[model samples]
Target: MSKDYLSVMPEDFSDFGLSQPILKAIDQSGYTEPTPIQTQMIPSVMEGRDVIGQAQTGTGKTAAFALPLLNGLRQKKKASPQILVLAPTRELALQVADSFKKYGTYINNLKVLAIYGGEEYSGQLRQLSKGVNIVVGTPGRVMDHIRRGSLKLDTIQSFILDEADEMLKMGFLEDVEWILEQAPQQKQIALFSATMPSSIRRIAATHLHDPVEITIRSKTATASTINQKFLITNGMNAKKEALGRILEVSETDGVLTFVRTKMQTVELAEFLTELGYQAAPLNGDIPQNQRLRTVEQLKSGKIDILVATDVAARGLDVERVSHVINFDIPFDTESYIHRIGRTGRAGRTGEAILLLAPREKSMLKSIERASRRKIEMMHMPSVNEVNKKRIEAYKSRITKTLTEDCSFFDDLIRDYCSETEASVEQVAAALAKLVQGNSPMLLEEKKYERREKRERKQPVGGRNNRRSSGRSDEGMERYRIAVGESHGVKPGNIVGAIANEVDMDSEYIGRISIYDEYSTVDLPAGMPRQLMKVLHNARINGRMMKLSREGEKSSGSERFGNRKNGGKPRRSNPKTSRKPRTASAV
Candidate 1:
């Protein structure tokens, strides 16, 4: 077929030829027009042609393959497995399976099962025994099933490799090849990959029978729909604080926050809920029923935010989700696209906010290049903005309550004024103050003080000078290390390690005093107990840290004089051998 053949949308599936129930479900799901990938690949697969689809993430790839696979399912046959879909990660596998489940829900005798690592194997085994029509899984787990003789491909009709490049990147090409070899020779092979590296092309040429090549060029296709922006922060905690501020300022109807791990899904959901957001967690650990319910609630406006791992939120269609927050940067560009695609859906304008730490800024550039669109840098909402939003929200609630129920409270207010022997104006003022207690508007003094403190605490220059005076202050812990001026230990390494491991910013780390025998670094006061333990167990330059106060007996040499000297440690050149001086000698 000509390359132009794939350029135009297919007319054959214009009607979808799906059963009435399936068509109704699709209509209810708000799918009006087919995405380019879906339009090109669905008809080819329906024709039983070995197809090669090249498209990036967020291009409706799941439906591109799922619609045809479901359309090909036989109604009267025994529920023996007929279609196999191999995906790279557990998240993608579950996502594809969910797509199949939704589209195939109306098809009788079609059972789709998703198998992947980190889940119960026996349950999958039992499901396999019961007979499944379609199986979507990661390569290694799929190979395990095949090895266990649980997944029989004897009657397989179609095999799809979704995100083939990702599977290769994850070192699953061997398992993919092995599984392909095990499948029936007559089976139709459809390979879908974001980028067709030579290796994937070789597989397509060898396995596919003169496959129709479809390439969907990446461009500013979805960029206009998505308002992409990034927030820069010192570190993770600062990112969280910025996220809270952004949420406060945003007028989002619903939000989806993408985190890296399932544990983070629960943790962030709980944190958001505690911050007075109606939030819930969506991850692999949540039961499928609950996952579906969560999505429905998000759609119905019961929950304002859904914290999810990529896997759990796949195939989720929540049209009201106006905002998508990347709580953690995705490992790959494709994942980033998919995460943001959760918003700006169905032709509705949506916003995607990314929180990037200093180190993660590089990944942002990579995503920009891959997506072929620039993500604008977004300033974090300042304290003033956050306070304004809070006050506005408070005012709106007050107006609504007063408009709806002023009669009931009028008697109570009069009684309070009479009992206190106070004028109505005075009582009303007191009531207003009580209602707006401790609001951000009232905390401007604290906010200003904190901002002033941060500005005053900027670090001074020079390695030696910084080490001497950096951390010699109240609320600093002195940590002793074996490597000092002799071992080439620098303040940056110490700061970098602590910042990376304990989620502390470099600014919070204090002075470093180097000596011939060892070095002492000052850390922030009230460091989490867990972080302190981590520091105790941490090794820098293969030397364990023995952390203690500055005046502790273990601090061998007072390279920097005690607090009395104002953290001005004696300077010594590493090239010259000088006797290490102690505090007592000074």
Candidate 2:
């Protein structure tokens, strides 16, 4: 127990003696009490002492250091980057900068800039030249500026390394070390990370001088307020329809749906929009200004749903986001935590629904273990459920309208009934019919069932991989590649190579078998000639994999084919043939 590193248990933000401006901003932001990290670490940071904090995601770590850094800044007329915060990703950089701005709203002439890759240099240069009080940026982009002489570090008083573990994992340790070394030696240092690996500890020991170490271990990665559930589904189209049905039935203020790829985000957003849902796509490709506007629109209720990739949705915090739909199961538990974290923020109740296939049940278990929360199995919303929800909403709308003043509408309705020589009841029924529009109120359960079945049905010889395995279905042609076990060519390798070459999902790929000298992959029929040519020259295991359809004799086969027993016919043994372990689609 070092005297300078005493533990604290503050009841509220006021206990930390934060400046009146910061306290006011916190109150306006609706935060009543400081989170554990903030309560434990803010005091030390504000006292100009070095500190190291270990906290999980969504634990309010940003505010822990941001408030203290802002309070420590002197109210000077001329500013030149007094505090430098290095974040791992662009999203985190921008988010940390936003936190600084929010907490220091009352501080005069306080300028914060977030520098990251993928943006024009002109804007960043302009901001740097104009002078900023604080600069938060990713390590690589920050190094670029430091090298270009655009960013000055001499005026820095406080240096912070946010998400140190993530920066290390992303191979930014060298750049981070370079930046850390460049900063003034006497400056106060604060390092925050979710995990404290030896490498992080080494840096902390070397840089931080008798720093107060505060560790806040969360029982689980996910928030307690989130209602986690999973719906078992199969196939891409079926999952899409199931998502639509879930969106139709759930009473959500706004939804953030997570997918695996940027292309999926755009396609799913487009599909939902076509179905009359107000939806938009958010991904790395979208410009930063547009991304900002899209988020604002989501918060303002202009968009009901957002389809986005994991990279795009990082650091996204919106209060009205009532639901998080994992349209595609996340590849890892960490990503799952981050995806669901979009909701259930600031103690708001949120719904996290995952579209899981039978094969994905194992991943669900992994997530449960990682988050330490059992995800309840949720039944798919049936047609009856959807119709009931719709009818309830319709009735609610009618009740609300009835409660409002409608004297003018009543007279118009009476006049219209008189002109048509119709009874009041008949006129009211006609009006109701007109309001419902061409879309049917009730969906046919059997119709959706039939569609799912039809989509699953394979061509005469085609076999659906989800339901069956082994042997290419009819119409799926077998192609041979010049790499196999001897060349360390695994099923994953072949699947990845073909999928990457053509932008096709691994699930869409058929069966695969590898021979000692060559391998065979089952692909959909009718591959474009140009794509085939491109894949033919594709390199795998440092060898040019020349692909050709089976039964097409190639001169290279007899010329360079591996013959195990001096060209003698090897016995075709079923057990010896390589059947691939299922490859997951990204």
Each model's TM-score, in the order given? Answer: 0.71, 0.79
Tell me, by lDDT, which candidate is best: 2
Off by over 4 Å in 2: 1-8, 197-202, 219-222, 403-409, 419-421, 452-483, 487-512, 515-586
lDDT (Cα, tens digit) per residue for candidate 1, span 29-136 = 678788787777777878888888787666777787788777767755468888999987665677688778888777766788999877778999999998898899
lDDT tens digits, residue span 1-586, model 2: 1322235556688877788998899988889877777777787898899998886777788998999888878867677999999988777888889999999988878899999998889999999999999999989999999999999899999999998977775678889889989999999999988778799999998988989888776634346989999998766767888998998898899999998767778999999999888899998889888888898999899999999987678778888999999987764566688788888877778999999866557678878887788899988788899889989988899999999999999999889988999999898888888998887878988998898688666332232333112555533567777886678877778878877875555644666665667766776554545557778888888887788886575435443345665322233457875533323222
Error of 1 at 522 (Å): 20
Assess each prediction's global lDDT (C-alpha) against the native.
0.73, 0.80
* TM value for model 2: 0.79
Error of 2 at 110 (Å): 1.5
Cα RMSD, each candidate:
9.6, 7.7
